[model samples]
Target: MRTFNMHEAKTNLSKLIDETVNGGQPFVIAKAGKPLVKVVRIETEAEKPRRRIGFMKGQLKVPADFDTMGADEIADMFEGKSK
Candidate 1:
């Protein structure tokens, strides 16, 4: 782990973050020669929650007129012709 003074860390924040993320090593930031904080990559793809597409596939049914099912009612409401 490399230690960076507060000034250095603030000056090259982007580069330091890149190195820490790519190299998989945590770096420390120090203030007045004392460690203040450590920066590390927290989550990788495997550690992140994945979005499961179609998780409920086949569990629900769609009617043939699904798209136009409410077309008339919505149009009537929009045109101030609701019953």
Candidate 2:
């Protein structure tokens, strides 16, 4: 990662972008001597999708007839037509 102060970052944005895109490195731009925002390369479509394995295990249960709802029963819930 490379760090750039606000002035240099604003004045040389084009070079910064080129470096970010071609070099595939992240950068941080700071202002008032304080660390600020960051820029990084984006994942391409061919990249593997990120998954959280077993993140939801045993957290949810299947509901029987979950897809089956009468028209009036569904509409009444949305339109407050059911008591």
Candidate maximizing TM-score: 1
Query: In candidate 1, what are the lDDT values of residues 11-74, reduced to their tens digit?
Result: 9999999987886589999999999998998784666778999999999999999989989999
Distance from true location, Cα of 42 in model 2, Å: 0.9
Q: How many clashing residue pairs, candidate 1?
A: 0
For every model shown, what is its TM-score relative to the native structure?
0.53, 0.50
Quote the positional error of residue 29 for candidate 1 in Å.
Answer: 0.3
Worst 10 residues of 1 by lDDT: 41-50
Q: Which model scores highest in lDDT?
A: 1
Structural RMSD, model 1: 7.6
Writing each residue's lDDT as its tens digit, candidate 2 over 1-83 gives 67899999999988888888896588999998788999887867786878989899999986776677476788888998866
